[model samples]
Target: MSTTADQIAPAHDEHHAPRGLLRWLTTTNHKEIGTLYLVFSLTMFFVGGTMALIIRAELFQPGLQIVEPYFFNQMTTMHALVMIFGAVMPAFVGLANWLIPMMIGAPDMALPRMNNWSFWIMPFAFTLLLSTLFMDGGGPAGGWTLYPPLSLQTGAAFPFVILAIHMMGVSSVMGAINVIATILNLRAPGMTLMRMPLFVWTWLITAYLLIAVMPVLAGAVTMLLTDKYFGTSFFNAAGGGDPVMFQHIFWFFGHPEVYIMILPAFGIVSQIIPTFARKPLFGYASMVYATASIAFLSFIVWGHHMFTVGMPLAGELFFMYATMLIAVPTGVKVFNWMATMWRGSMTFETPMLFAVAFVVLFTIGGFSGLMLAIAPADFQYQDTYFVVAHFHYVLVPGAVFSIMAATYYWLPKWTGHMYDEKLGRLHFWCSAIGVNVLFFPQHFLGLAGMPRRIPDYALQFAGFNMISSIGAFLFGLSQLIFLWVVIKCIRGGEPAPAKPWEGAHGLEWTLPSPAPLHTFQTPPQIDPSEAHG
Candidate 1:
């Protein structure tokens, strides 16, 4: 087995890759496809972020200042859709595509053609969804959840949104399949299941979750399509269908989908904490078990999201306890991260800053989640700004922060140049402060009896809304600094060694900075002592 850095392909294979735009279109290379995924995700991030700024801008003042209420609804609906499916999910998948093969010491993803197809589907799917905004009835104003009846009321946008969702689902399922296949079959000699990096481990579990639930969402949306156009009544109360049943099916997919987004973040933090702490991860096997436990609990706790929908007392109690039970494993993970850092020679690079912030802030999100888990408490919090605050805390600082951490941690390796550290820290601070200010006041607004998804609020909610809007602008603007950091690093910077971070571990670190287009054509031998559990 070879332990060498990725090497350029032999001269005979050089011409096989097409030049320029054709290279991107026809390439089956994992690294190139991964770059494509990252670039697309960045584009969508701004697209969705623009929608969010519009929402914040409208709510910056008291009443109907910027856009009409219907347009506001479209912004809310499309913002959630674009962020969840287009921005966050694709970012994780992009990371998977770039790092998974390298981590496992495989040359490329298993089923390369499927990988290419999976990525190409996204731009078209999103285009179809976004095109609806220009149509007669405007884009989906029914919210990202696409709850029935209201969703059924959507005009020309109905079929387009549904079809776009189906296409996104199909793309995700295929990407998940490719991930599972690559991880399961393409590991190098001695890279056993447990020996694989935590990033790889979390993605493996996430892929399984995707396989299980994406189809459920696909089915639910298909039912919606049928109910709307074909006179079926899967969720139409007029035809004897139960709208509550739609909530059940949707949440069944929705709760696990939440974990699907965050679980990869968990893997990333698990990797970074140990690296910066200059220690092998603490309780490595326990972390793996804890991740699996959280995944298992995710399926059972979907009912909590629907506690206010008039579930029977017994059902409500069942969901409440099940939801609370997740805190146990999550607590384990948090404890392990702290323990990993306990008394170690810890450093606070940009990546470490984000990872540490993920722990504290995401814990805040989790505690609020616990608050929501209590069935009786949920009755107050549901459909309120508190719920908005809770999830944004989880997502923006939790998952999105982890993605940023990963970019900083690996950018040196990816670009073979060290980024400007000072700028990176500035981006992190602005993001951290801005996110809290943006979200913390929303918690107060929810407690003050403010509802979510409304464009305008009563005069009483004005001050906190103003503060939240300011934070939104600050947070949104901070990302430009991040964009600048990435671009600058790509063009020119201090040249990096193969292993830029002294504490970093894994097969990826073993490869050179700016790893070659093709890597590990001969499998690398794994050293048990160096395995990142």
Candidate 2:
């Protein structure tokens, strides 16, 4: 009689999967593409981090000792572009690729060929973007927002930057389409929408958000391209176009873009907390609804970013209240996370430590966000280090930390080897301390009337800037430990079991550790009792 493994194994042999460098270049396998995206993301993370350190080095003292003012601006601009587009977003996409099909018991993404194409496009897009830094104008320095006139001043780099952005947008949109198609069409039998994991649900919502907003950014940049070269004047003051209109259009896409980066983070944290707490996620339905609510609120609150632009009092009030309204759904998610951990057999593993930090630190960011949402208060904080601090808290601890947690949570399954927990904890503590020391003082700097995006600062801002720079170095250096841990695990470690975490519940854990090149070739049966809820 045939064994159970023989009965359930993929119809084809594993050797049928492509091999060698050509496999990575041309293969349609979700797992390989996911690895490519992840490795690319990690590479870019260091690239972006280097730019950040350059910035800190310059600001280490009140004077501009290290780099020229324009180069400083370039560092700030390029750093945001690299981190947002190159690092964090792709890292999340990589996670989705690796886990979504496994979670829902699909054999592969619905559009595997398109998935391959999506990953391939990113390298070229970023290459074109980074190439601009060497051009005469020294990259687009008007900020990643690329506000026009100032952005219009960008020289030979202009068209290249726009093209690079378009390429990134195309890649993102195609990836989003793949995600939606996969989730909607490829779920295993009995895997109902409500039964899917939060990570899948969040990506579904995020995919829609991507489809909706990526084009707006594409359009805005296209207009910028036209105004610069084709003379269309969409944001030109002399041509009777309003520069502020660019801000309006940008923020309309920009704010939802923020949620696009974050909703999945909420999803990641949602998955981790319950696993470590040894509890079914508290208020699962509420968490789903809250994520949806946050996405909805994101579109209406774009005006808050433009409050200092002198809108009418009514407009300001409306944006302020709408922005504040987001807190309701956000609060629900936070409360549910805490409740899930309440009185449970909690394990403080690396993933849980990061998850817990995400809750606390992200809440701090949220509170600071509320302060910025106050129309009058934003006037004080707008474009200062306070704004910088607020967002870093959100993106770093909030989004980046969640990504790190997911890595630790799933690395065992991916590598079939457990990461060194001792070293993992060390990375966590160093990162946690370093990130705070880097960002926290900036809030005080902004409150004390220090402006942002400048090479030099007033004498009063010196002490905090120095402290912040030290923190930046600390945080940047700590990432080496993270890199070491990942490499070490991949090379050799104690073998991991299929279910490394006792409390973990998902279809992913049903597969053998270091999940096969092909999985769910025959759809795995879903059990309602084993659902993540």
Q: For candidate 2, give the lDDT of residue 411.
A: 96
> Each prediction's TM-score against the native?
0.97, 0.97
Residue-level lDDT of model 1, residues 81-148, one tens digit each, is 99999999999999999999999999888877778889999999999999999999899998898888
Candidate 2 lDDT over 1-533, as tens digits, reads 11222233455455775678887997677887888999999999999999999999999998869999998898899999999999999999999999998999998777777788899999999999999999997998989999988999998999999999899899899889989988998899999999999999999999999999999999999999999888787898899999999999999999999998999999999999999999999998998899999999998999999999979999999999999999999999999999999998998999999999999999999999999999998888999999999999999999999999999999999999999999999999999999999999999999998998999999999999999999999999999999999999999899999999999999999999999888988889899988863
Clashes found in each candidate (C-alpha, N, C closer than 3 A): 0, 0
lDDT score, residue 346, model 2? 97
- Cα RMSD, model 1: 2.9
Candidate 2 regions with alpha-carbon error over 4 angstroms: 1-13
